[model samples]
Target: MLGERILLGPGPSLVPPEVTAAMAAPMVGHMDPDLFPVLEETARLLRQVFQTANELTLAVSGTGTAGMEATLLHMVKPGERLVVCSAGFFADRLIEIGGRIGAEVVRVEAAWGRPIDPADLERALGRLGGGRTTVAAVHVETSTGVLHPIADLARVAHAHDAAILVDAVASLGGADLPTDAWDLDACYSGSQKCLSAPPGMAPVTVHTRTRGRFRPATFYLDLEGLWTYWGAPHGYHHTVPVSLVYAMREALRLVAAEGLPARVERHRRMTRALWAGLEAMGLELLVPEPHRSPTITTVRIPAGADDAKVRTRLLREYSIEIAGGLGPLRGQIWRIGLMGYSCQPKWVLALLGALEAVLTAEGVRLPKGDAARAAAARL
Candidate 1:
């Protein structure tokens, strides 16, 4: 039942065979000498994928949420000011974590389907009187499929001497993100997304300014300690997930082989095809052009179409997996992810054709067979 369906959902996207094979390659003790090279190469490849040269770039032993907590744990100390752009569900996670950390939270929000306005972010930072602050933003908000302007927001934050953190859980490998070039202080992305790996590990990259202190309030989620275990001295922070590390290492290697620029273009090309097909079927995208995430697309469910029913049909009949929107967008937007190995012509065409039949059956009328035709035309 596990491998009976295609992964076209928000993520953990389709894991390529190469990555899966690597994860099953072999197992060794965490402290074994042979594992050191695996750890080293994993760090190097993670840096390449993260697009940073920082020595501290390494994978956390948990999901993206663990990465988020580890990030905010050391940086956003009690009583400090932190600003998060809440455009969708994941951005609210920053607000929640910041509140938990006793940080003064200033939230700048936008309509769900729109990218966060850099002007609004700037204005919010200006309220801080140039005090050192941290700005948190989702690189691609999965709930709404809006790609926020990370570089511009980073520039604004830097001008005011503030740090910038990004949650790239949905857009890491599927889109273009140059961490060092964009002056992003710290960011974390999940292995499940564009990396085309399993969901346990979170690759985190930290620049010098936000390297954080040794042994923060928490022991398990300490960033620097994690780096130490993954880096020099090789001290054990926690029992590492060896298989997940191996898979992620191979995933990054695949990304490096494909080249980041070409990989991003591939995702974009596939996104264009999917969008064209969906639109041709008279389905509107929740996020408008130029701001839509290349990795995941949010399509409006047609009037009178039951969102859960359509998704169930897709999974039950076609064995294709996609997700519904989270938070306020639930039952309104069908999230179709074209990411990693899933961002291919065949998958796109299959999803479109099956979606056509399912929607037609659900009484949501559309031009018969037009979805596949439109998608092929784009390809």
Candidate 2:
């Protein structure tokens, strides 16, 4: 049997027992009367977490990418302009998906480990001259652990008369992103990240202004169609995973009980401790402090340390799971996530101590016995 593992990767953060127990409740038919209220309550909780008053809020039945494709498919028409702020792996995904949908995709790129500058985005949109254009950005670039300024970018897009869509797959409940306050036309996130739920549902909110702009090319991901089923009449659109909805509802309740402000602070505090621990062990972080993500942290592999070996040892010996970098950053850095229920001081200190030991065993030089102490001091 596989051992119980600590999930400290980019996603699928440690699911709390309450969420799992909620999922274990007996399943109900998708169209059953009992399920409608549950769906309604879930959408209400999603709005609380998303900090949006948009009526078009619901959970898609697929993962985070499903939510991404839904917003793009609905908002961008063929030959329309889609401006994507490219910096890391997930941002490139926006560019790729836009192109595949036959949109004229443009990129406002920044260095991988750096946040996109709103001024750069402003200039790019200025040149586009805005006609049915959409600006897309990743709120938290999971691959690089950088948090872009979504509100500022949204303002820039609006200034150019363009609609803005945000991929908050890695931010959502873990970080502060006020959907309505930011004026994002659409925003979507994954259940597995900061929501402390399993990997199926993708919570999405579409501003009223974004509705009816264009008919989505696909039926399943159509935002308005999904909303119709989740709202007033509660008509059937598709067979959503009833159990997963249960899990999402419970997880969202947990988010509400802890309160978003406290939860965000906890994530920040834990990240600071982790940063202190890693730095004390003579490690370098990828993203600069100002732009770093509260939930995910990317650390540079020491010159002599093997990225694959270190991660493997972490999993096999310590029963902890963190991830390596993607795309051009492969073998260059480690991605450590402290999200949702996993964002605890104990886990932060535990990973620091375990990582220090593994690096030492790998013959990597470090200030012996300093990592955990530094992290504890901050905690």
Candidate 3:
């Protein structure tokens, strides 16, 4: 049997026991009467976590990328313009998906580890010059561990008369994102990250501004078709995963119980401690202080350290799991995630200790106990 790992990677953070138990409940039919209320309550709780009163809020049957596709497909028609704020790997995904859907995709890029300047977005919108464009951005770039400014970008998109779509796959419940307050037209996230559920459902919330107005090219990912099953008459578009819905609802319930504000603070606090510890151990972080993500941190691997070897040692020796970098950053950095049930001081300290031991064994020089002391001081 495989040992249970301390999931400190980019996604599918540790699931709490309550959510696991909810998934174990007896399965119900997609159109069953008992299932509708659970779906209704789940949508309601999702609205709470998303901090929006949008009536179209609900969980889609796929992962976070599914939500991205749905949002872009509905918001931007074929042959229309989509201004993407590209800074990291996921932002590139927005560009790729937009191109595949037949939209005129424009990219406004920044350094991978930095936030997008609202001025840059304004300029991109200015070049597009009017008619029905959608501005897409990533709230938290999972690849580089940078938190882009969604609220600021939203304001710029609105000023230029364009809709805004946000990829909150890494932020959502873990970070401070006010959907309605920021006037974001569409937003989506995966259940596996900050929501602490299994890796299946994608919780999406679309503002009523464009609700039921446009038909997407995709039949299955259509927002109108989805909301139809999620709300009113309760029609069936696809066979909703009853077990995954149960897990998602229970996870959202836990979010409500802890309160979003408290949960966000916990993520922030834990990340700060982790950062202090990593720096104390003579490590350099990829993203600077201002633009760093609270949920995922990117650390620069020191010279002579083997990225895959270090991560393998952590998993094999300590049963801890972290991730390596992606794309051009591969072999250059490590991605450590602090999210949901896994974002706690104990796990942060455990990782620091284990990482230090691994580095020492690999002939990397570091003073023992410095990481723990620095992290504990913050805690």
Q: List the residue pairs that clash in candidate 2.
A: none
lDDT of 2 by residue, 139-169 (tens): 9999999999998999999988899999999
Taken over the whole model, the C-alpha lDDT of each candidate is 0.89, 0.93, 0.92
List model 1 lDDT by residue over 322-365, tens digit each: 99989989988999999998899999999999999998888877
- Give candidate 3 regions above 4 Å deviation: none
Q: 1-379, model 3: which lDDT tens digit per residue?
A: 9789899999989999999999899878999988999989999999999999999998889999898888888788888998999998999999999999999989999988889999998887887765788899999999999999899999999988889999999998899999999999999999999999999899899888876666778889998899999997799899999999999999999999999999999999999999999999999999989999999999999988999999999999999999999999999999999999999999999999999999999999886779999999998
Model 1 regions more than 4 Å off:
1-3, 212-215
Give the Å error, residue 159, model 2.
1.0
Candidate 2: misplaced stretches above 4 Å? none
